[model samples]
Target: MGKMAAAVGSAATLAAEPGEDAFRKLFRFYRQSRPGTADLGGVIDFSAAHTARGAGPGAPKVVRSQLSVCSVSESDALRAGLQPVSTWRAYGLEGYPGFIFIPNPFLPGYQWHWVKQCLKFYPQKPNVCNLDKHMAREENQDVWEQSKALLRCKEVTKRRPRSLLEKLRWVTLGYHYNWDSKKYSADHYTPFPSDLAFLSEQVAAACGFQGFQAEAGILNYYRLDSTLGIHVDRSELDLSKPLLSFSFGQSAIFLLGGLRRDEAPTAMFMHSGDIMVMSGSSRLLNHAVPRVLPSAQEGNLPLCLGTPLPAALPRDTVVEPCSVEDQQLCASYLKTARVNMTVRQVVATDQDFPVEAAEESERDITKEGICHLEDKITHGKRVRLDPDS
Candidate 1:
């Protein structure tokens, strides 16, 4: 047989030019360090993730084609310090069914800064980069930076000071569920990050969500001790759409079992910057993450993607780039953990997300709760869970 086609091949050399103004406005939000209103002006913002639908991301000047957005040449990824794990059947119906993993598309420095911004996005703040709540904060702990001084001095602290990303038992985003009430609370709904908005659109194009629109985001932060039980993603009004998942900072052994828990699950590796899309059959499968492996840390991941890094953030632009020290620090931190951000369209349109339900203050306690779980699929015969979990 001919060489297997890579899911993210270098055939197309299109660059991602979402524009300076877009970045400026966006990073400005980061610079200011204040939480703005979570209520977006219109569905247009929500439609940022959609492909071939409405317009595309950063298209105020010219309409960008889907191919252009999704096409990140191998050279670009490599130059950006990343590599695509290739496979002929890595994606598509004829290939390995419905799941695809494209490793490290963004350059390490770029990705590092982007992730930092995402972690500090205020609205998602505190909980976004949470610390172990069960353990009380030590008066002498440096929450932002892990200290080696304590170990050097033999002044052992009661517990290791870890970021939320380091020791989170579990964390959820987008819509918060009232477990006692078994209903989603409107009070808890917040707009997904705009920086990630375009990314959803780009990945949607690659995954064939021709009309992808981001309605929700669920972030699963894990340490080595963590495990995600089997579940599905069916809370959205439309099942036809796709859910885009991104893995960062560590590797995990993901099990793709058949339709039920009774059957055994096949194992797969999920590393940093790997993208998983759930469309078609793989969208519905029984999957679980039983264990996490330490990631082969690559914050300065050296590849030759051929894309040039921005020399500077632009004048008056003035947002801080990740210092070499910062990237090194982050790389060290991510060496043994993982953060999974899964974005899905809860409803195709604003109208589809029931207005009445959002307005309702409380859920009916007498009714059985809608507990949807599960995520993208992999190689297997199976029934999956909802995107909510």
Candidate 2:
């Protein structure tokens, strides 16, 4: 089915009727406070038993876990000091209840440093052309054309490209120009401020991924009606690496499925402060945002600064200001649109060294201009070991 049709169908399935308790159950689920919140101590044992009983292969697994909830007492709700809030488990979609509070788990020292740096170097104006614009100007044109051609074709063929690994490329920081006059662009793994790199490392460590390296970070803003179709992120990156995604501001429904593009998978409503790590066997899963609900004018979730508006604002208006009513409304509208910052590790296949020999040596060997040095070294090393003994 076409993307729009599928989106419409999904929306219809999730649509609420008049007087029906659509969000009550979900809201209550997140509001409840249970002790041992961080304790996945028992859940793992239960999951193992369940998996043994013919659980589907795609069933969610307990990857790395953490817990944090809203500090209600500290909350200005009643002008009281920040009280201890309930902790919650951050599992994949399966472990998520309707609502959960994800804390900003950055170390206070590092967080304060970055915030100060950003404030000090804040841009006065937006840059006209950024990595997204350049990418849209270059790769997007080809993708658009390919998509059109696919639509025109009567029968589609799912053939792998000639060089699957080579298709993945890397964009270096030096190549990107920040148009917004801001010191920072959306490029991932840039060598600046040291804090971002550290944050990326923490995320990678939490998710049990090794050799995590990101060349560029894509920053996308979704307002009303902004939507991305069901597509896999098969850009210039090694598919072997995981795509680590982080969402902030507002909330939206995330539709995720299996490797096949046509497979009917599951859907989850991802809110702000949520993190999703897609890796391992699920690296190639197809995912997309079908739609973004309009943000309410006021009373939305507080931004990072604990303020409704930041000094360097991007959107025309804040989705939700600090108000109880606005929070509720923002929560409802978040079911529509949210800003998602997805971090991916892109491996540049072309620049990778050959497994057997150095680049120059490999070229010479391939051209029949030299002996296989790796084999000779192996043979020599084997004999030398016996001789030494």
Candidate 3:
């Protein structure tokens, strides 16, 4: 389809954990659909997005079933209900990169669990980092030295673009998406965490990417001035699946552009707790964050994320001190920083996506993974850098 078609009704099933199985039968919800029963009184949709899927020759059929509508009440206002789809405003020039969204999945109380999971599983420092095989650099000793110094600094700040040592601070979950080599390979990988995999599926399901398995993730740490160089992600064997992204702490100026680096990217603000989905034609477009905005910009949104979250340390038997330390480090640092967690599918189907070609190709051009997804984000030429002193 040239433009992504919006499905009228949403479908979802909620199942509690095994410990709560006994209560499932007692409170079964038998939601039924009847025509012309949409309640418009309690809700307001002021978005520029036209009423999707109206009736005509090629019009969509009226579905009086379960529906979720997330429209902008104002440039900064947000409204969310039971649905777990994307709700923040979207911007794009051509309709080629289709954006389908749902209501905000971010909840103030419980949704913090996702943030906690990120700190628990991912590493902020490169020494113990399991991603990208930074340990394999036979000659780049600077990567190790710069990374060590980057972690030692307690205050959050982005260094000049002349050096990309800050990127070495991120952690990758799932399949360990590799940027230097440009593909996912078993030769270097970290098994995708089960909790994060399930979370990715939940976020994807609401946005029409059902059965989506999260094969890769790049948990990017953005200091107040950090800027991700523009890039594209074609490493994944499958582009059909939607990419899931979550923003925590400070906001960011996300850029979405055409297929090449020459295309001037459109900028948008991504608030913490906000979710972004990129599917259909938009899957392979060029995108990047030129800078991490200060927390002062929280006035426009983040009404749900009231007052900064306090430092939390969740216990895990396997990785106790590690998880706790990460939590404390992130919690203290995030007071002036942001953490962008993006999930993407790497290998398409069960087929062998041999990384033989990706490793040999010397092409330094930037490609993308998906919406707001920084899969294998590298410092490409598009980004403006400060001249070295």
Model 1: lDDT of residue 179: 40
Candidate achieving the largest lDDT:
3
Model 1 bad stretches (over 4 Å): 1-96, 122-159, 163-173, 177-184, 295-320, 359-389
Candidate 2 lDDT tens digits, 246-299: 555554555555665434444454545555667666666665654333334333
Best to worst by TM-score, what's the order? Answer: 1, 3, 2
Pairs with backbone N, CA or C atoms under 3 Å apart (clashes), candidate 3: 85-102, 86-102, 174-192, 232-367, 232-368, 233-367, 233-368, 233-369
Error of 3 at 201 (Å): 0.5
lDDT of 1 by residue, 243-282 (tens): 7887766666554444544433333456566666776676
Candidate 3 per-residue lDDT, tens place, 1-389, comes to 21112111111111222343211211121112111232111111212244233221222222212212232222112122112333333322234445443324443433344555554435533212323333443333344334433444655333523123344346566554544455554544567776667656665654556578887787776655455655565667787877777777766656555665444333345666666677778777766665555554432224444433334423321112224444444444455567777788866666665767445333321231222222223444222221000
2 versus 3: better lDDT goes to = 3
lDDT sort, best first: 3, 1, 2
Alpha carbon lDDT at 284, candidate 1:
68
Q: Output the TM-score of candidate 1.
A: 0.57
TM-score of each: 0.57, 0.42, 0.56
What lDDT does each candidate get?
Answer: 0.44, 0.34, 0.46
